[model samples]
Target chain A: MRNLTDTELAARVAQDIPDGSYVNLGIGKPTHVSGYVPEGREVIYHAENGIIGVGPTPAEGEEDLELIDASKRYVTPAPGAAYFEHADSFAMMRGGHIDIAVLGAYQVAQNGDIANWATLDNTFPPAVGGAMDLVVGVPTILVMMRHINRDGSPKLLRECTYPLTGLGVVSRVYTDLAVLDITPAGFKLVELTAGNTLDEVQALTEAKIHT
Target chain B: MDKRLPDLASAVAPITDGSVIMIGGFGSSGIPFGLIDALLEQGARGLTVISNNAGAQETGIAKLLKEGRLAKVVCSYPRSPGSIWFERRYEAGEIELEVVPQGTLAERIRAAGAGIGGFLTPTGYGTLLAEGKETRVIDGRGYVMESPLHADFALLRAENGDKWGNLNYHATARNFNPVMACAARHSIAEVRHLSDEPIDPERVVTPGIFVHSVVEYGVRP
Candidate 1:
């Protein structure tokens, strides 16, 4: 199947999410998943600032300053939304309560290692933040990212060259070009975007693709 | 009462290997470049660096990456070239890398600084972010794992600092610096300039008491 657009990509990803699944969407494009969650599926959105039952973005002129996500972006609280102290929010992540974590990655290796956080340049610093906790805590890690860098280098690689966020954490990857599953056998092609072929993606990737 | 860059380096002599250190910034902007330079000059290796992102290659923390001085890195995103370290080390089975989500990164460090033990966040609930972790339902919604954060040293940067060590941030560059500052045991504030008196109470982003040392230098990248 050809996934034509980001919206379509989101909808496709949403299809796999079961009803009443607890999820955390990373910043940037992953934040958009809140809008695409299947209707009446009871998906609870967790903001790092301690809000759940996250509704979609609000209508114009109806913004709530008190309601915001982890990224500080304004949001609409769902019917059952609840808020708590920041401590309580982290307890949930550390306690192994969350079911799914979709994050953006700079690169994912054949072994499912994730290197989304820092680069290796000494002159440039690295920020580890909570990725270490999340990668180790979460069970099914999904990486949402572009297929390639602006310089045309592959973010999906035979091996990551950047500092890793977690070792052997990522299980699935969704990119602008294709959806792949990381296995001991390497990256298996699940689907491709419209106008992209397996060969073209393979040309850009350092790993072999099993259709 | 005041000292030059060399003196500042000497004051920081206690910083050592395996130390959990915090550096302030959002992405690559607003980092403590001069102190980082000092750390580079001092050649403190095998450090555990905590920041928003590793600096760009050859500019910020990337210098540490090149020197191979960092023992481990805890961050939200490590950008280009710096990523090569993982490839050679992890893929080749030599080094260790730990990843964290952006919001979770901010909250964990903030939690540590605030003297809180832990909290529930829905950020990484259903997918891989929840693996090998406990899950709880608060009001019928599942929230995944969350961990508390703390550090030995916090290296921060700010727009201005009062003699008392009060500080302020420039903009979105304010991301994780202030929060990380509070969570560490010792904090060093590096600023572009310092004032004779304390900054206005309302404008002070980080209180002087939380900060032990002040480095006057160029603004961080």
Candidate 2:
């Protein structure tokens, strides 16, 4: 069975974004999701670093140094864009004004606990930017990442061994191998990548995947 | 009152050793680099800093960290790209780091500025950052009790400043500057446009009362 490429997975994830929803895209894989947003759907992007209505990347020479996303990448402001300070910006998330957040995850437990910011590694400093905040208050948390670790270990787990970003926070996960929803019961299979079987995808997950 | 200062060195003169200074900016923008450089030249040792990032490379907050001027840094993200000084100091156990969730940090600072003693927030609940903090379940959601994070001084950048010290920022560069302005005992601003007239009162993002001084940067001769 063939797995979806990261780009393919991002495109697939973008298809699910509801039109007119206010969304925040985390760094890495989740950042690409907005680029693949379905045609005719209008999503107002929020950058947690203090921008609402985040737009497409600017041409190389046209970058406004003052305008950048949370990732520090240069971007144009979308029509009706607004800028605010960190306080008001995060307030949008913490107050549940932000409808959805697309984040990257290290592990997602059956109970929807996410661990992304820190691992056992202390060689590099642990930086927890807005992941916890995004998970804590954003109504829907969509994690986009690989189905398994680089070492081939499962990232969809019975329980997360890594430090928790938030408890029972993830609403759904779009992985390279499959898409799943974290229901009240547990991880439920939504769909598999093209040419992949449910059993094949289930084998990679440490959590029981209810079809 | 004319809050304008003659130079960067004078702008940072009030910041002393052991001061808890908040530097405004997220990533590479909105940093009061001129003030930070002046603080570097002014040579005040042993400070605690609050920022979105610790700093990158040898610029802005990184410069302060590299010079061994920072004793502790309260921030959300510390390891910025090219921020080798933080990596070195943290690994060497030469610095103390308090990693707060980005939203929590902002709210804490806002709490101080707004004169609210403390607030319950869901931002860091159940995470290591929330450890030992009083937590409660309110309305079926868990929240951690966090205190206001006040600083002795704030150094920030703005796109424009008027004679009255009213400030307005450029695009996303406004990040922590506005909030930090109100949270500190003294706030100094470095602006690209320091004008003789007050900014349109309606357009002022930060009122002059929050600012203690202002200095012009990127001025053309």
Candidate 3:
């Protein structure tokens, strides 16, 4: 079966975002989605630090220390960008002003609960930054991540073992193997990667997947 | 009346040991580095710092942590990629950390500044962060009661300011500075430009009433 590359997964996720949508792209793999947004779509990116209308990453030597995204990566402002304080930024988030939020996940349950912020391990300190706010505030939560863990264990599960960022908040998930939607019935398989069969994908998923 | 201070030492002189202080910034932006240096030079201990993140390694707040002056830190993002100082101290139990949700932390500080009592937020309701907090269901959604977070001193950086203390912040550098200016009992601003004349009223993001003193720092072009 052909597995999608990280950039390919990002492009697939970008294809689903509608034009002129105000979106927040979470740190890590989700940030890559901003670069793959289709041409002429005009998606306004929102950074939790205090910017709406975030633009593309700046070229080398053109980076500004003051203009940075939540990831602390240098970013240029799009035309008509606006800035505010931290409280106002989150108010825009929690008030449902953001149409969509794209995030990276460790596991997603059939019930749509997302676990991304923390693991059960004691070595890594768990830090729940803005994921809690974004998951609860944004109307549509889209998760982009690897379909399985490093040991080849399925991450799409009946219930997440890791601490959840939000309960039943995820609407859709895009992985290297397939695109799935969370429904009242369970995981509804949208499309699988080329050369992959339903049975093969289902074998890796713990939850009941409807093709 | 003019509220300008002649130097950074006098601006941060009021911060005594065991004081709760808010230092404005997101990562490295909008941080009052000059004032923080002054505080380090002053060598006060047992400080409780409120901020969005523990500053990067060997700079700003991390330096203070290295100096063993910080007793506790109340922030949303305590772990950054280069935050070795915080990580080392945290694991060793040398310092205390209260990790708040980013939005909740911002709102709590705003609540303190606005003179409002505790408020309800849905961000941390079902998460581990919500543990032991008051929870209420409003319109079928659960919310946790979060109290206001006030500090004794607020040290912030501004892009511009006038003698009257009206301030302007540049780009994303405006993150926590304005709100923190109001939440503290004494707000000291380290500004790039200290003008003899008052800043344009319409351009002021932080009104002078909230600010106690302003010190001119970095060069302005």
Candidate 4:
């Protein structure tokens, strides 16, 4: 069956964002969403490290060590970019100023509960970065991840087993196989990748997807 | 009054055992490596360090954890890319780690600098991080009451600063330096650009009042 590549999925998420929207991208996969913004549609990027209007990656050998994104990936500033300390930066988030947040998740439940931070394993330290803040603060939350884990277990579930980053915060789930919305009634199918059937995708999902 | 320090070692001289120090940085950006090294030489034990990330590879907070001087760390993310030092110490029970949500951590430090006792925030509500904290529903949404996180000393890095302690941070490296400078009792700043004349007042991101001392660390790597 056909599936969307990571970039294509990011592109899909980018399409959903309205023009002039203020969006905050998570560290890894979600960062790619900024690069795929449609032409003529402007999106202001916010990095919790105290930057608004985060721009593209700087050319190699030109990285400003002091200047970086939340991922510390060494990014350039967009036009009209501004900087501030942590307080003002987070106020833009926790004060409900940001429009949307695109995050990577390990598990998402029918109630829109998200789990991305803690693995609950003793080997790795549990780190909860700005995810909690973004989920609770931002008006809309978008989760991007693969349809299933490496072991092939469903990430779309009736209830998330991992510790939640936020309770009932996720608005949409963009996976390789399909794009689904977490509604009051449960998972609602928005669309699917070409060559993917509802039965084929539903077999891999732990919860029932309302078509 | 002039607050320039002769050396990085002297900048950290006032810090002692049980000192709560805020190291300004996120990942490698804005980390005061020279001051962290000087603190290693100063050898104050049982310290509590606060920052966004613990350390990556062998530098930054890793140096302190390696010296076994730190008793605890209050941060949002203890492990960033190449943060093995934090992992080893955490697993061995050599360090106590208090992980706050990134924005909440920032706001708490900001609250200290801004002189507010405590504030209610929507972040961390109903999550494990808010387990023991007080919560209230405001306008049908849960908010957690977080207290200010003050520090005895704050180690910071900036792009430019003057003798009066006025500072201008380089790019994203400015992360927590400004707020940490305000929150600490005695804040020390290491700058890439240092001069005798004052920086343009309008251009100064952190005013002189917040910074206690300044040192010229010179250009970038």
Candidate 5:
């Protein structure tokens, strides 16, 4: 079975985003989705740090010191970009002005609970940045992550062991192996990466996969 | 009246030990570095800082944290990758931390400025962050009660300011500065340019009424 690369997975996620959608790309792997947005599709990126129309990363030596995203990575402003205070930015999120929010996840339950901010161990102090707000506020929550943990354990589970970022908030998930939707019944398989079978993918997912 | 101060030291001189201060910025964008340096030189101790992150390592609030001057920090996302100073201090119990959801933090400050008592937010309703907070269900959704957050002093950075203290910010650097200016009793702005004439009223992101003093840093001839 073929496992999709990070970029490939990002491209797949990009395909699902409709044109002229206002989207927020969560930090980490989800940040890569902005670059793979299909041509001619004008997706307005929102950064929680008060930028609504976020543009692509600037070339070397062209980076501005102040124009940065929530990830602290420098970004350029898109045409017609608007900057406001943090309160206004989160208002856009919590007020349901954002059409979609793409985030990275540690685990996803069959009921659509997402656990991404903190783990069981206290290796690093639990920091819930803006995930909770995004999960609850954005109209659609799309998670981008790997199919399994480093220990080869399934990430699509009956219940998440870690702390949940939101309950029943995730609508769809894009992973390295396949695209799945969180339906009222359970996990519904949308499509698999090339060379992968339903049984193989199902073996890695603890939740019941409805093909 | 004109609120422009002569220099940074006098601008931050009113801040004494044990002051609850809000330093405007998200990470490093709108951080008042010059005022931070002045505060370090002032050597005030037992400060309660309110911000988004605990600054970066060896700079801004991190330097103050390393000096063991800050008694408490009320913020979200204090554990940035480079925030080792806060990590060691927090683990060792050297400093106190009150973590609020980022949106809740901003709204609390906004509430303080707007003179609102408190509001219900769904951000931390079901998490450990919501522990000990009052919870209410409205329309079948749970929300936690969050109170307003006020400060004794607010140190912020602005792109330009007039002698009247009207201010403008550069792009995303405007984060938290405007709201913080209103939430604090004394709002001090470190501005790149200080003009003799009042800034255009329409372009002023922070009106002069919210500011107490202004320190010009990068004024060009």
Candidate 6:
């Protein structure tokens, strides 16, 4: 009965992130969550290269030269931060130690199949980085992205035509317009953008939505 | 003269003038500002450096650019000519620039670490980039051949590391460090925290065997 705004949607996603959770915020928009995490709550941020306990982006003059995130963006060090060889960071991801992996996706199938790495177009060749490892290793997968493509195509579909990063790995979808829970029954609309109607939202999505 | 490799640096010693080094970072992210500071403090001059991108003025690998310490550079881009001391030297015919495609640069470093002599890829074909490079056809696809590249020394950053030199990289800092470590004759790592033994071996990103030196100072701008 209640709708959420974009900022509210971000807060909802942030609210679900428990304290002390080790999270990998995928590149692009997912990186924005770092600034949204409620202050005073401790969350350990892991970059693929090897830094952890990352705080939000530093102010212009306050950045530490040695500290940065997987995106190569400058960051501050959280208390008790440690650094090590890079293989160990991937090992943590591969060994299923990371609790949450927040990623961006091009398409999410009804069965939670995620296709984020590549497109069908050969002209736009894709880069398959550590994303394959993340989907397989991270226990919880949270996808943060825009609800639709620039051409106004719905990214959430009954099936993904694009190459999949992993099958049935997405646990939740955080979009600009709504929050969704990918379930066995199909995509369940958990929350909608404020002032937007279910009919309007469903019209925008190609996938069937269950209230 | 002994041909065998010697022991690691016992303590923090100043980097000498005219040293060749490889910096680990993508763009400005993992540029090893602390090491740059150490280099600046040492006032090393006439250095040869390799990296992905020269950090913009006052950032990343660009600190060396600001210091005008480099005698030569090999990278993808030249953002700050004024800050890059070597660029002026290059114009004056006193420096060298070995430009490379971003992907090829990474692959070259990787090939060096993997012990491969050379590799062929389509990343740069039929361009000035292919000049003087070997070309081959694999499965009817043409690829420009490139040789493996190794460094005299490599500087890297990691998230958390154990005493054994096992490393975990923060997100973007994972850029060039892993590959550079493998290609370098000697590897020195800068980490935020150091763990005692009994570190979960599964969590190790880089093995201690590859690491010859450790700098425990956390990343400070």
lDDT by residue for model 4 over B36-86, one digit each (tens)?
Answer: 989999989999999999998889799888879899999999978888888
- TM-scores of the candidates in the order shown: 0.55, 0.97, 0.97, 0.97, 0.96, 0.58
Specify the highest-DockQ model's number: 4
* Candidate 4 segments exceeding 4 Å error: none
Candidate 2 docks at the CAPRI level of medium
Q: Which residue pairs clash in candidate 2?
A: none
Model 4 per-residue lDDT tens digits across residues A85-151: 8878888998899999999999999999999989879778998888998998899999999999999
Chain A only TM-scores, each candidate in turn: 0.91, 0.97, 0.97, 0.98, 0.98, 0.92
Model 3: CA > 4 A from native: B219-221
Candidate with more favorable, higher lDDT: 1 or 6: 1
Q: Single out the weakest 10-residue window by summed lDDT for candidate 4 chain B.
A: B212-221
Q: What is the interface RMSD of each candidate, in Å?
A: 9.3, 2.6, 2.2, 1.2, 2.9, 9.8
Worst 10 residues of 3 chain B by lDDT: B212-221
Candidate 4 falls in which docking quality class? medium
Give the alpha carbon lDDT tens digit for every residue of A45-71 in model 2: 999888999999999888887788988
Model 3 residue pairs with clashes = none
What shift in Å separates residue A5 of candidate 4 from its native position after superposition?
1.5
DockQ (0 to 1) for model 1: 0.12
Tens digit of lDDT per residue, candidate 1, span B119-215?
7766556545457878898887667667788999988777787667777765334445677778899888777777777678977767776777776
Lowest summed lDDT over 10 consecutive residues: which window, candidate 4 chain A? A82-91
Candidate 2: deviation at residue A132, Å?
Answer: 1.4
What TM-score does structure 4 among the candidates reach?
0.97
